[model samples]
Target: MARLSGLFLCGALLSFACQDLGIAVEVKVPAEPLSTPVGKNAELPCSYSTSVGDSFALEWSFVPPGKPLSASHPILYFTNGRVYPTGSQAKRASLLQNPPTRGVATLKLIDAHPSDTGTYLCQVNNPPDFYTNGLGLINLTVLVPPSSPLCSKSGQTSVGGSAALKCSSSQGAPRPVYNWVRLGSSPTPSPGSMVQDEVSGQLILTNLSLTYSGTYRCVATNQMGSASCELTLSVTDPSKGRVAGALIGVLLGVLLLSVAAFCLIRFQKDRRKRPKETYGGSDIREDAIAPGISEHTSMRPDSSKGLLEKPSSASSVTTTKSKLPMVV
Candidate 1:
C-alpha cells in the first residue's frame, strides 16, 4: 500500500510538471472566430506535440455553451498513427489525417446540423505525464430576410408634368418585400401626392409641381435584414412651364404639317382634273376656228377632217384662234 501511494504521488507530481512545462494534455483548439453554415462540413483543426509517444492518448470532444467538456464522450481519438474506436462517431464524425506524422489531428464532420455548433477540445495524456491539449470554438449563423428600403425616380419631373421612377434592392435573403417611400423636407405638407399601383411597387407622379418635389426612396426588407435608398427631388420652375409649353408646341407643329399636306393634295388634284394645255390649242377640234380673221374653221392634219380638207396654208394659219365655248 505504501508503494502504491508513492507511485500515485509521483504520477500527480509528473502531471503538475507536464502542465507547468505546457505539455498540452488537455488543450484549446482555437479561441478565434469561425463560422459555418448548416448542412455543410466543418473541420476542427488541432495539433499537439509530446515527449512520450507510446503512452500518449490523443482525444477530441465537443460541448455546447453551457455543457461540461470532458463529461461528454469524445468525438475522435488518435494514438501512435492509428485511429481509436468511438462507435457513435461512425455516422457523424471522422478523424482526418492532415500531417499525421506531425501530430495534427483534425476532426471532419459530415452533414453538420445546427445543434453541432459549439466549443471543441483536443486533449493528450500519458500514463505518468500530460503532453498537449487545446480548445477551439466554432459559430454557426443562419441567414435571415433582407431589410433597409429604397425608392427612387427614373427621370426628372417638370412642373405640372409626369414622371416615372424605379425602386429596387441591393442585398437581402431570397424573396424580400419592397415598398415606396415619399418624404418631404419642408414642414408644410403638399397634399396632391399620388402613387401608382402600390401593389406593383411603381410610383408615378402626375401634374408634378415644385412643392410636390422632395425626396423619394424605395425600401426592401425581409425577416433577417432591411435596406433603404434615397434621392433628392426638385421640380422645374413655373416660369419655364416646359410641360404645357412642350405639348402646345407639338400640337402647333402637327397642325402646320396637316395644313401644308392639305394644300399640296388640293393643288395636285386640280392639276389632274384640268386638261393639259399645249401651245394654247386642243389636240382635236370639230367646230373650232383657227385664230385668224377667216370665218371658216381650221382643222389639224390629224383630225377626222384632215383627209377631207386639202392641205392648205389657210388651215395651218399660225395666228388662228378657235371660237370654242369656254370650259367650265
Candidate 2:
C-alpha cells in the first residue's frame, strides 16, 4: 500500500511540473502589424501544436524598442500550474488554457496606449531540457489623426467632367476610420467607394464633377480621440466660357476704386497743410507783395524829422495827353 501511495505522489508532482515549468517554450502568432489606440484593449494570440491532454507553460512579454527580452519584464507567465503577472499587467492582462488540453496561450491587453506599442514575444516551456522557438512575430504600430483630404476632377472625352477625391492619414497607435460628406446637398443614397490601402490610410475618389463639388470632409477616429478635415468645393461648369471676362471686369473695378481712394486721401492731406486764407483779400494781396518791397522811403542823413522840412511852395504843372483818352 505504501509503494502504491508513493507512486501516486510522484505522478501528481510530474503532472504539476508539466502544467507549470514544462510548457512548450515557443508559440505561434501572426507576423503583422497590430492596430491599437490609447484607452482600448488589444489581443496578442499564441498557440502551441502538441498532443491533447499535455500540460505546458506559457509566458508573454513585451520588450522595449531596443531592449532585449528577459523573465523580469514578463507581462504574463504561467508556472506552477498557475498564472502570475506583474501588478500593472495583472490588472489588464488575461490568459486562456481551455484548449490547454492542447497548448494554447493568449494574452489580452486592456487600456492600451501609444507607449504600449512594441515587440511582443510568446514563449512556452515543457521542462527538463525541452524548449521550442516562437512560431511568428507580431509587430505593432500607432496612428495619428489623418491629414486634410484632397479632391480632384477628371475630364471625359464625351462627358463634361468628373470629380475625384482621396483621404489619407498616418502615424496612429491603432487603425483609424474614414468618413466623407458633401456640402449643400442631400447625403448620397448609394454607397460610395472607399478603400484602405495596404501602405497608407488614404482614401481615393474617382470620376467626380461639378455635382460632386461641395464641402469635402475627412474624419479620423481611434480609441484615443477623433479629428476631421473640411473643405468647400467650387463646382466647375463646362458651359461657362466667359470666366476670363468676368475676372477682368472685377480687376478693373478694383483698380479704379483704389485710384479714387488714393486721390481723395492726397487732396485731404494737402488741404490740411495749407493755411485757411481767403483769396483776393487785402491781407492776401499785401502778403503776396511783401516779398518784393513795402511802400516806404529811404531817409538821407540830413532829412528833417517833422513836416516843416517839406518843400515851401510847389510849382504845379499839367501835361497834355499825347492822345485823346479812350471813352468806354
**TM-score of candidate 1 to 2 decimals:** 0.35
Q: Pick by lDDT: which candidate is best?
A: 1
Residue lDDT tens for model 2, 1-328:
9999999999999868865754434567877677665567787777875432324566677776666555336687776567777745678877755334356676788887666777777766554434556444566554444444333333341224333445555444355666666556644423453333433334444444445545667666666566676665555555454687788899999999999999999999999999885666444553242332333322224345543232323332232355868779
The lDDT, on a scale of 0 to 1, for candidate 1 is: 0.63
Superposed by TM-score, candidate 1 places the C-alpha of residue 157 at a distance from the truth, in angstroms, of: 40
Query: Tens digit of lDDT per residue, candidate 1, span 1-328?
Result: 9999999999999878766764554434565645554567877776655554566667777666577755556676767766665645557877677324356667788776656665666666655644333344444332334544455576557777777766665544344666666776564334355665533457677777777677777666656566767777778776667788998999999999999999999999998999875654545565655444455544446675556454466544446466898898
TM-score of every model? 0.35, 0.37
Best-performing candidate as measured by TM-score: 2
Q: How well does candidate 2 match the true structure in TM-score terms?
A: 0.37
